[model samples]
Target chain A: MSGHGLVLRNICKKFGSTNVIRNLSLNVIPGEFLTLLGPSGCGKSTLLRIIAGLELQDEGSIAIGGREVDGLRPKLRDVAMVFQSYALYPHMSVAKNLAIPLLMRRLCAWQRIPVFGALLPGTASRKSEIIEEVARVAKSIGISHLLDRKPRQLSGGQRQRVAVGRAMVRHPAVFLMDEPLSNLDAKLRVQMRAEIKELHQRLGVTFIYVTHDQVEAMTLSDRVAVMLDGELVQVAPPQEIYANPHDRRVAEFVGSPKINMIDVNVCGGRLAEIGGQVLPSELTIGQGTLTVGIRPEAFHLASSGEPNSISAAVRLVEHMGSDLFLHLDLTGVPDPIIARLPAASGHIAPGNRLHLRIRTEQLLLFSENGQRLKQQASVTPLREYAR
Target chain B: MKHCRLSFRTLGRHGFLAITTAFVIVPFIWMVSLSLKPPEEIFQASFSLLPQSWHATQNYIRAMTASPLPRFMLNGVFICAVIVVFQILICAPIAYALAKLRFPGRHVFFNLVLVSLLIPSQVLALPLFILAYQLGLLNTYAALVFPFVVSPLGIFLFRQFFNTISDDIVHAARLDGMSEFTIVWRIMLPMAVPALIAFSIFSVVGHWNDLFWPLIAVRSQELMPPPLGLMAFKNEDTGIDYGPLMAGSTIVVAPLVLVFLLAQRWFIEGLTSGGIK
Candidate 1:
């Protein structure tokens, strides 16, 4: 089935006096896997709850498939959610838990009686149909053998799959998941992440997944909406968010080991003075202090006398299987500068001097207030020198 | 040396338990002995653990034949069962709302429940009697069952139990198209079996042995519960017969003891765990 698009307009929410969501608007195209990525208590889960009709937004309108659903209850919204705790009915067997939704929606009050329902003419057929559907969904999720078992009898990963299977049975136009994999062990989390991605592709439904994990957002989502303190910072593809971030907070929050910050003085419009050395820049900024952010991988090791290089003492070295991260202590910089390099790029010990080179295009300049500055066209290349 | 100390500790524990067990079981043994003894030996001036002259069959026969004792027991069973079932139906939803739903004056209502728990039921007997009389409900099952159908204790117990359940499950049920009524009865009631069993024991025992309310509100012989019926049997002009009286008491107390024996595991677990939170 083709999935339907979702549109949320000017959603505002408050818990007591604090505004948890501030006029947030989002649009999800049909059959797109969009992840809302944020830290804990950033209101991402609350937003998902609002869309599912579990919580009513204070001031907003939600439309699913072009129909406004402002006052509709969750069941009428045609959207299903998989909770973080896997919220399975503990007293029911797996098959019963999966069949409850269909039973409630399909059967009338007279047809739900235990003995009489079986005796009713069409009730028997509907009952068998529900069982068959439950079994089919269970088999698809590799939980066919667990149909008779209760929720407590399953492992964490198995319970998570049952929760997803329950959501899938409804075949709703939209699927909302709130950290559905946070309870698993590390290895199982990675495995379930891949399975969820595959499930999205198979169903081709509009998926709104909420998570605080950047890696899950990066790997699974077609677009990641980064949130901080209840406001959307940026919404873009994962690579664009990583490589070209609009806000300094987005850049810092998205990357591991964190992007490095260096305070430099801009001289005229084409040069930046850093630690008693002049570096050429293509940016035209006012003559003042600006914060420069550079990724760890942007720095590379150079010969001791290489031009346009900064020399500093190595403070520590962390050796990963595929990469080496060196912490360097420069004379004027307040924090240690970290550089990631290939693991086989020669031995580097602490207390040894190291020279690193950074490309002009790789340097990201931000003002003191954390707004990124655009670079202008270059007139000439600056001379190379070592310090 | 350590092995010797361990055995000594074990012996001491068993000795203490033995003493406590005798303290609790001696009264029941005495009651059974009295029920089996003849009238002449019941007040004998000797310390006897067992009946010297066995009149068990005659005493039981007289107890049943004397004054509609079995009918009184049937009434007791019907009344307690109705009260307990109605209490669960009325209390479970209130408890669920008090624990999960956020509405206006929720805290005030909960505080009122706490305050009601402090007021003894005996203090309200006079007002309840007046209300029953005005409604023309005295001497009927309505008077006997109405005041007890809404038990503050049951509501508090169920609220505490429901609080332990995760809210996500309730939300999940709502999203699955179940209404609040369905969530309370179908979903929560099943998960609260232990608490229900424990509350059942408390409700059944409390109403079964109650003499004050039934004496005040129910005056007809046919409407009297076990305790009042037994009292009526003992105070007959034929004078008090100790053997028959004890036998009747045993008959009245038997059902609750049997129920407790059958469900002691869930009862004990519910009491201990419900108290912890």
Candidate 2:
């Protein structure tokens, strides 16, 4: 089957008085796995439901496979969803659950009666065909043995697989998953994440996955759309989103331990000063106040008499197996500067004095209103350094 | 000394339970014993747990032959069954909508149901009797069954039960291409087995033993339910036959007890499961 692309244009949704999704537009390419990553109550799940036709947007148009599907029901839209709760029928066997969509679409009303249907002509063969298809899907997902068991008898992970299997059996053009792995334990979540990635690869169907977990978005998505407060802040590949975020909220929301912010003064169109120390820079912006964002990994231990080095006292050090995060109290800085270094870098203790250095290329500059400021390519030093 | 005190508390609790159990069970035992006794042995001053003479077969035969008792029982079964089936059909959908769907005046409708529940059936008996007479439905099955077809208790019980089910399951059914009709009957109905069972018990028992409505609505012997027929047997113009009256009472009460015994497990399970959830 050919995979279909989805386009959601200018979608705006309001719940009573609160605007949940505000003029949001996104285009998902065919056979690509796109993730909408955001915090809880950020309207990501509402957007997915709107695409599936489970909820109608207050103002917007949605097109699946080049056809507008604004008024179509979920089943008619050819989209299947794997919910966060799995939402399996607790009383039916796994096989019956998987066969429901197919049966509903294919069989007539009279042909669906439990015992009488078998007595009708051509029903026996059709039912066998459905059973065969269900078996094939079950075997592919490695849940063939669970076909006879009810949902209550299965573990969380098994039920998750069965849910996925149910969605796959329909062969829908698009698969929408809403936090499908949040119910599983930590270890099982990782395993299921890989399985979902594999399934997308095997089927080559367009997937629009919504999740609040950053790691899931980073590890599984070909492109991640970062949303904040019901608006699309940034949409790019994971590495670009982490490094070259268009908005400050995207930068702060994606990374662990958060990117550190320090206010710096740009002097004479080239020079930058932090904490009363004039630092070397290649910036050509006019004299103004700028906020500098520095990742913890960008800080390195200063060599003896190294240029652009700042002295600070270590307040705390957190050992995280392969890396050590040092909380340093820099002079004239209100908040502690956190630096991530190699675990075997040196013998460091609390209450010790140390020097740290950062390269100019690793520093990001933002205007007072949290907008990124482009930097000039030419290198220029302060007048003191020129002397 | 501590062990002794604990044993003393256990004994006191068990003793209290034993007294209550006897108080409830003694009347039933006395009824059965009286039904088994001959006419002379029933009035003796001395009380005994078992009848002095075994006249169970004779009494049962006379009760069956006396005043169309079997026909009355059949009417009772037919009326109760029809009433229960209609009640489920009428209540389940309204209950589902009230519990899950949003609409204007939903709360007002539910409040009306609650208020209707507080107003006992006896209060409506006169108006209902007049309406039945106007419709020419008296002395018919419609008169016996129509008043209870829409049960406020059934709707209330089913609404509470349906509220306990997660809405996600209903959404999943919709995504699976099921119409609302199929979702209610196929999905919600099967999931509501316990509630349905409990409702069936309540409806059957209430309508089966009811003497008030049938007494006012029905005038012909053919339309008399078991309770009305039993009353007729007691107050026959010939005389009061205590032995046959007791026998007929036993027959009238046996079916309800048998039904409870058969569905006792499901009855308790349905009530407790809905409560815990």
Candidate 3:
């Protein structure tokens, strides 16, 4: 089957008086997995639903495979969705569930007779073809043994596989998944993540995944669309999102042990007063008040001749297997600064006074209005700190 | 002394349960006993529990022949079946719409249905009678079954049950490329089966026992229901010939009791699920 790309143009959806999606636009490449990532009520799920044609937008246009599908019914759209709850038909066996889309496609209306269909003319071959196709898909998903069981009889992970198997049987042009792995346990979620990634590679079909989990988006998506308050803020590959965020919100949202932001003054051609302590960024931003964004890993244990070491008292020490997270209380800083160091460095403890250095190149500078601060290409590189 | 006290406590507990059971069973037992008694001793205080003479077959024959009981029962069955099916078809869609669909005037329409529930059936009887007369449907099965089929009660129950189901299921079906009607038919309807069966029992039993609508709507003696037929039978078989009327009455009550026993589990679950509130 040929792959299809989807496009949403100036789409705005409103529910009653509330505007859920505000003039959002995005383009999906053929045979790519794109994820919409945001928190609850952030319109990520609503945006996905709008794309599926399950919901109508108040104003905008949608195109699937380069054709406008404004008034087309959901059945005519040729998109398969894997739901968070799975939504398997409770009355039907797993095989029957997989056969439904094929049946709707291949069988004539009159041949859908509950009792006479098998005996009817020209129906036997079609029925067997559909059944064989369903079996093939079930086997591919490793759920061939569960073909006869009802959904309720299956475990959560098995049910998820069946859901994927059902979607696979049709081989629709686009697959829309709304948090399909959220219901699984932690281990199952991780296992399913890899399976789904491999499934995308094997099928090479377009997938539009919606989730509130950042890690899922980072791991699973070829491109991630970051949404906030129903608006598309940024869309980029995973590494670019973490290393070069477009906005201050993106930098803070995309990392675990979130990025530390401190208010600063970009005064008189120099970086001054980083939370009332002088900082060394040599090339200054525009002369205005700004905020400095620093990832926890960007800070290191200070040594002699480090350009921007700030002194602080350690408030708490947490030893994870690979690293130690230090919560530090500096004299001028309003909030505690966090530092992540190698676990082998066993030198830090709670209530100890220490000097920690901020890696200059890794520093993220933001404008006062939460916009990222850009610099010229000639900035100094800290080669030893690179992971 | 301790043994005596324990015995008394156990006796009190069993006595309370036995008394409550008797109270629940008494009306049913009395109906059966009354159906068996001879006409002359029907109201007598010293009447024997068993009949002085057996007229069981004879009473059944008279009940059939002396009145239009057979025709009335046939009418009851036809009317009840039609109403039950119509109630499900009509109420299920309305309930599905109110429960799932987002549209203008939904809250207003739901409130109107609730208001209709508050107005007692007796208050609507005159207006309904006039409407039936105006439509020239008087004395027909349509007059009895049409208006009663769109039960506010069934809609309320189905709506409540549908609300318990997550909307994500509908989205899943939609993305599977199923039409809205197909989604309702294939997904929501199956999930709402327990509610539907419960509502069916209520509708069937209600229409089976109702006499007022049939009495007011049907003028032909042949179109009467079981309850109305029993009333007419009681008047014609007066003066110690109570056997036929009692036999007919027993027949009328038996089906409901049997149906309840057969569906006892579902019936209780339905009632507690939908009606306890």
Candidate 4:
């Protein structure tokens, strides 16, 4: 299917006095999967709701399939959502649950009446058509055998699939998902994550997914929109967002084992921690204290005789099987800085002091205000990864 | 640990419940027993729970044959069914609006229902009676059915049960392209089967045994419900034949007892639990 695109312009929403979505505007390309990633209560779900017309925006307009749908109802907007709780009709069997949307769309008022409805002209034909369609979608979702069972009889994973199948039957212009897999167990979550990715590829539908889990956003989307405090902080491809975050909040929120923030000052063209020299600056800078963000993987064990290696004490060592994370304390830095090294790289235990080098090329410098400062050097040359 | 030795607290609870149950049930048992006893035994000085001899066939035949009792029962069934159906049709949507829909004055409307609940239907009897006379509905089945069609207690009960259903299910239904009424009939009502049963039992029993309202609004003998007909039967002939009266009482009470027994599980669950999950 060739998916339709969505354009949200200046969407603003407020719950009572507090702003929930602030002047948010985004353009989603046709057939592209975009994820809205944020912390809980950051209004990503509210934004998705606005796009689906489940909730109206206080100001601004939304377009789906190139048509303005600001005042339209959710069903008319040609969009379907898989809610976090599944929201399956408790009274309906799986088949009836799948057949409901078709029933509402295809049957007239009198045509849906109990006994007389069966006697209505074209009702039987339409009903049989609906059953066929429901069967097809159920087969596609691998829930064909479960059609006779009630929602309560199904496992969590099965319910999740049925929820997806409900939306899939519609073939709407856009698919909206609000943390649909968050309710599953960890193993099921990982397994379902791949299924969702494959589903996205197979349908090739424009998808707007809202999630608080960064890993889901990173793995499932063609582009990820990082939201903070009701505003979009940054929107870029996952790799680009991870490597080059435009805002400090985005940098801090995106990575696991978090990117460490170190306070440093410029001394004789070299960057130094509060009480000791750290790394030599490759780019020219004004003389003032700044924050430098360094990813854990950017640090490496220094040779005994290497220049500019900072000697630090290993406070804790976390063995992650393939890679080992060493929590180290520099002479001046109060908090421990973590370094992820190859697990095969010799035995390093807690309390063992090791000299470590910072790959100057991969070093991220920030002004006092928490904005990333680009360096003059062009580097895939993360001067650290070479070691 | 699994032995049947009862604690003091458990013994007290069972003791209190048993006494109340006997107090409530003894009259019905006595009625059934009296219906089986000959008229002379019913007036005997000696008290007995069961009759000395069976006059059940004669008493039941007399009850059925006397005073158009079958006609009275049919009227009761018709009035109760109409009242319950219309009450549900009107109350479910009102309850749905009160419970789920977001609109201006929802709180005010729900508060009004609660306020109406605080006032007994007897308080409205005067106005309803006058209105029935003005509409020429007095002595007609409409007089009995109309006054109860929009029951506030039903609205309140249904709204409470609807409140327990997740808002997400409603949202999902709306997105599935169902109209509000469709959601009420197909989604909300089916999910609320227990509550409906509980409400229907309350409605059917209340109207089935009702005598006071029917006495005021409907005066014709043929239009009278079972309870009212039984009263007319008492004043008709034989002055006060104890046997047939008890037989009619048993007949009138039988259907409700059977209904309650059949739906006892759901009736209890509906009263205690709010929603399916």
First chain TM-score for all predictions: 0.94, 0.94, 0.93, 0.94
Question: What TM-score, over all chains together, does every model reach?
Answer: 0.94, 0.92, 0.90, 0.94
Across A1-387, the per-residue lDDT of candidate 4 in tens digits comes to: 879999989988999899998998999999999999999999998898788777889999999889999989988998999999999998889999999888988999899999999998999999999999999999998999999999999999999999999999978889999999999999999999999999999999999999999999999999999999999889999998998888888888988878888887765554445223345556466577777888888888887756656788989999999999888898877788888899987999888878877765666777678888776322232255235
Tens digits of per-residue lDDT, candidate 1, B1-277, equal 9999999999999999999999998888888889999998988999797887789999989999998998999999999999999999999999999988989999999999989989999899999999999999999988999999999999988898898889899989988998898899879989999999999999999999999999998888999899999999989822668898889889898888999999999998777666643
Error of 1 at A211 (Å): 0.3
Interface RMSD of each: 0.6, 0.9, 1.7, 0.8
Candidate 3's displacement at residue A360, Å, is 1.7
Best by DockQ: 1
C-alpha positional error of residue B191 in candidate 3 after TM-score superposition, expressed in Å: 1.5
Per-residue error for A356 in candidate 2, Å, reads: 2.3
State the C-alpha lDDT per candidate: 0.89, 0.87, 0.82, 0.88
RMSD in Å for model 4: 3.3
Model 1: lDDT of residue A202: 93
Instruction: Grade the docking of candidate 3.
Output: medium
Across residues A108-223, which tens digit of lDDT does each residue of candidate 2 receive? 87888889987989888888899999999999999999999999999999999999998999899999999999999999999999999999999999999999999999999999
- Model 3 residue A299 distance off true place after TM-score fit, in angstroms: 2.0
- Candidate 3 per-residue lDDT, tens place, B1-277, comes to 9999999999999999999999998867766676776666677778566777776787777778888788888888899999988887787788889989999999998998888879888888999999999999999889989779889988888887778778877776776666666666777778877777788788889999998888899877778889988887777654357667778888888888888788877776766666554
- lDDT of candidate 3 at residue A373, scale 0 to 100: 67
How well does candidate 2 score on lDDT at residue A11?
A: 96
DockQ of each candidate relative to the true complex: 0.82, 0.70, 0.62, 0.73
Q: Which of the two, 1 or 2, has more lDDT? A: 1
